[model samples]
Target: MDDRVAGALSLPEDWPAHPDLSLALNRMGSFDWDLDSGLMHLDRPALDVFDLRPEEYNDRPADLGQRVPEDEGARLDTMLVQALEAGQESYGAYFRCRLRDGSLRWTHTQGFIRRDADGRPRRILGIVRDASQELADSVARQELDEERRRRTSLVQATSAALAHARTVQDVIDVLKNSRGLAHLGAANIVMGLLEAGRIHLVAEGPEGSFVPGTRYTKVDERYPMSEVLRTLTPRFIETPDDFARSYPELWGQISHLGVTSAAYLPLIAQAHPIGALGLLYDDRAVFAGDERNLLVSLSSSIAQSLQRAMLYEQEHDLAEGLQQAMLPRRIPEVPGAQVAVRYRSARLGRDIGGDWYDVIPLPGGRVGAVIGDVQGHDTHAAAVMGQLRIVLRAYAAEGHSPATVMARASVFLQELDTDRFATCIYAEADLTTGVMQMVRAGHMEPLVRDPDGSCHKLFVEGGLPLGLSAEFGSLDYPVSTVELDPGHTLVFYTDGLVELPDTDLDGGMRLLTEMVRNGPQDIRRLADQLCESVDGYGGEDDVAVLLLRRDAVPSPQPGGRLRQHVAQNDPEALSSARHMIRAAVRAWGAGERADEIELTADELITNALLHTDGGAIVTIRILAGGERRLRVDVEDRSSALPRRRDAGDAGVSGRGLMLVDRLADVWGVESRGGGKCVWSEFLIPERFERPGRHEPPAHHELPDRRDRGGRDRGGRDRGGRGGAGRERPGGDGAPREP
Candidate 1:
């Protein structure tokens, strides 16, 4: 007791001499493995670390499987193998250990690799310890870091969604529908916009949570939203009692909703409060510091989006109103045909377009159909469209030819102060005669639907668009005369109808053609069908459509007449003239004399074009006298009279005067204005004048009106006019077809 240092130590019976005493105190143990023999040894402390008694584990590490989970043991083996193969000096890992109670506990093992002098791994020395206490402390920190990451992700997701919101309502929808508020433990949301010193509630929390008097509340009112808006600061309610005490007026109504807590944040943008947002939680009673900060940041993002959306909607409304006002108010009912028109605005905000359609009633039983789109998608485009529409209608009303109308309109657009140009297609349709004079100005081809529901596009001679034609000095839009047989439909549309993302023009056209063929027969229904089809393709651009279908049976009383302008060398114009005559004859019940009348009319038209320097204008009408004769007149600008002439039998020449005199009951020539009218007539039966039936006689298969008399429309030259059919003059009768 007196003195030696060894004698002064206080040791237990298992202390100083026990090798594992120090390791057991620290819950650590050692291990030794013989790699070549595949055997391992664990000291008493190591065996305790694995929760195995002395008899439970043998020298083999595999015997420790009763305490160490199979997966953990395999992981330890893999770690040792990798360490030995690399000649690593150390390795460590934490794995689950099975305890005596069948509960798994975390355990860690660190090993040191022992190598032979030649560098071969001979064995591993290591220590094993229980890591449950070490890992428990870190678990709390991990949870905190994970929460921070989730909140950051929440802000990013919400901002991304708000960035696409284009209206105030859109911002509300994102909050309600995108689960942005749900992540914050908010069962529902309430939002209010500040307007005119008042709070206008845009969203009233969850379903059936609307407060009776809170929809419109004053800034001084006893409401949470109003309080936040007035103070421009966020308010956090800790509990239902806190909400009830702070604002008893509002809490009384929402108390039944089981809202235990809430956070009302002022929506401030650029230092100005524009609105307020309320996040109501049905279960939670308090908001953490991080939750409060996150909600504040989200409020800032929502404020910015709401302000942007509000501005966008305001501008969109003004521009859309301007566009609608500029367009035609209504389409009038056209005689002898069914007409339909439609328009759809674009999907983007403030992208109002200049697409427009109009139906103008013209003189002489004719009507003007117009479909056009100006160059842009803005207010300026709408203004230009309005001006162009007015001036165009004025020119057409003045009885100008289709080509002249388009040319003058082009010049007008060129004179306007705007740099925009418009693509337009103008058609002057003679409903009674089944004829149309089409002029295209840098626009898409018009589609024609046959009686059998076949669709095809017309390739008319085209000039530059409205403003461009005058700029390029190419105002001569040649006229393409088209024949619309009874029961046929003419379709005019802006490019929007045939446009789709990632599709070429031809593909779009094919899709449109197929839809038109299968669409409803009625013009009104067909127009609706086409508009519905546009919705499927994502209508990024505005569209305007016009459909005109000729009456199946054109039955006009007496005084029904049709006229066409024939160009000097344009076969289409000439053929159109013939169809005009043919349709008039059959429509007015002169089918019996159709052959005789058609021959006489052709001879006179050929004479007018060949003998004169200019083209001729042909007019056919049913004379309303007791005789009920059908009259035909071909007028030219030349004042010279047509004199009867003779041709030899071998002549490809003028017996036209003799043939007309034979076929027509009366034929004559007279000078009028600065020109002369070569006239012919055939007396139709009295029974035909009454026309008890709507259709022509069945025996006569009406010939093709496009190209008749073995003459093609594309031919540029014809034999001399000295043929046997040539005419100089004849008796007092006009040439026409039946």
Candidate 2:
């Protein structure tokens, strides 16, 4: 027997056999191998380690090669053979073993090899210790280190994404793309703002949450969001039960949504809670402390960005409101013409500009159209524009010609001392005669389309812009007149329409004219197309366009007349006249003007009744031509003709004839066989007309003056030498002395 094996098989005389030692030895199973017989012997403890029955292994020694794993068994056999052949005292190897129960355990074996005199191995003794638990612990530590590095990288990426977010939606999109949050087990994310005691959902990621702009009352204490807002802290709900316990009413809804866990953090800005950020998980998940801290920090950055967006929105709304208020509330219903106007602001974050257009009702049935662009786009410029528009309207309404209006507006703007200039084009159109007169002040020329669908720009003479030096003289604006045949159109616009950055003015004008010429004939459709064509061309300036189309005459109606008898003293005659006018307008397919026509008819019939003692005859006629006209005639037995009187600031009664003068295209008195007739005409708007019709001259040509000390041949005083044969005040075919 080997000396080491003999010593392990016998006990020392004074050895104490401690229980702890016995237990330790049992945990480490012992194995003995007989090299000559090629069999292995395992003790009771070793049989327990392999889960083998004692009777099975005791009668037949187990195969050591089959007991260990194939590769490990090969390694152990080689080590034992080498040790015995070299006469080595001890040998050991670490390997995996598969027990009879079909489970694997890492085992390390060490033993003393016993050999004969020639160093041939006869028997082997070894102890097997299971090392499965220790090996598993080492692998887990390595995986944890790798996960930490990944999480750190994700947090850094998320921070960079949030820093560059520009808008509320941008911030939400960045949060939604957070791979780190998904890796850390967040399934859904939502961003909301608290306003007016309510939570407003601003953005939802990956999938929609409820609906955008969804509102929830913050006073509802049962909601987790409400609690988060109240406490201004972060909260983690670990399970459905936790949610149910805290919010019984909301538990059913939340459970139906399959949310097993959630985290809610308040979005704080400027040290105040503005809103809340939320993360939801379908499966139960626990958030680590560092992950929660990262989310909290992200919430702060998002809140700051959101606050800025909100402020910008508020200011945008205010600026838009101011601009809208300064524009025309409604386009006036001009006879024989259709007008369409459009205005668009600059891109977001830009101040509202002072580009404005107006359609004002001028005296003598003419319409005044104006478009102007101020020097700047600030609030000061907008204010100046508002004041300037009011002043222009006042001047135009006071019966001043287009040139006079432009000159007066320039003077008025200079008086304001705003230190800003503006370019404008003021035009007056006489619907009855199809004549349009315009005056430009350092502004673009008017573009006109003939009835033949051909277009050309009117190179009207222009003076200095308004608000410039006041030394440019009162009559500086030169008026240009053009005859608009039926179906003709006139376009007036600001520089924004034809002037782009680094682009030639001629090229821009050509582009505009081509667009207008090929555009639809309908005023509204043409306006829309023109605006769309130049939608993105105006870099920083605002765009404004005003279009006017001369309507063509409709086919004549069979019998378009309504007549009524009025008693001189009866008050019902006025009402009867108004009823007749309304019925006639409706029959003529011009019911839109029923209100204004009825009011005018009432005034005419009342004047006849108040001025004469005899009953009068009232007639309403809808004239059919290239331009339809509504003619109202009131005849009384009195020879006195209606006359216009000066109605100063406080005079209310004299405004009757003044209203007739301002509202009607033309009003005059004619002497009939038995009475004096008072008549007023209103041109009805037409849609289409026959082409190739010759346009009438705006006014007859006047004889040349000899310049005899600024006197005509008849020695009559010539008006300021501006132009000969200027349009008469009433826009009648006759000429008046200037």
Worst 10 residues of 2 by lDDT: 720-729
Off by over 4 Å in 1: 1-26, 32-48, 53-63, 116-123, 136-143, 210-215, 241-260, 448-461, 485-488, 518-526, 558-561, 622-629, 644-676, 679-683, 686-738
Candidate 2 has a TM-score of: 0.52
Estimate, for each residue in 1-738, the C-alpha lDDT of model 1 and write its tens digit: 456877887868855555577788899889899889988999989988888888888799778878877777888889877877887899999999988999999999998888889999888888999899999978978989988998999999999999999888889899988766777788988999999999999988888899887778999988888888878889999898899899997888888989989999999999999999999899897788888999999999999999999888889888888888988898888888989998887767888889998899986678999989999998889999999999999999897878889999999999997889999999988777666788899999888898788999877778799989899999877777777878889899888888888788899999999998888888889998898888798767888999999987665556666666788888877876777677777767787778778888999999888988888888887776666878888999987766655577787776777677666655566658788788777767656443247765532443322222312234422122112223334323222221
In the range 591-629, model 2's lDDT, one tens digit per residue, is 555555676677777777776777778766656565587
How high is the lDDT of residue 694 in model 1? 73
The CA lDDT at 117 in model 1 is 94
For model 1 the TM-score comes to 0.83
Error of 2 at 281 (Å): 4.6
- Reference-based lDDT, each prediction: 0.82, 0.70
Query: Which is the leading candidate under lDDT?
Result: 1
Give the best candidate by TM-score.
1
What pairs collide in candidate 2? 553-626
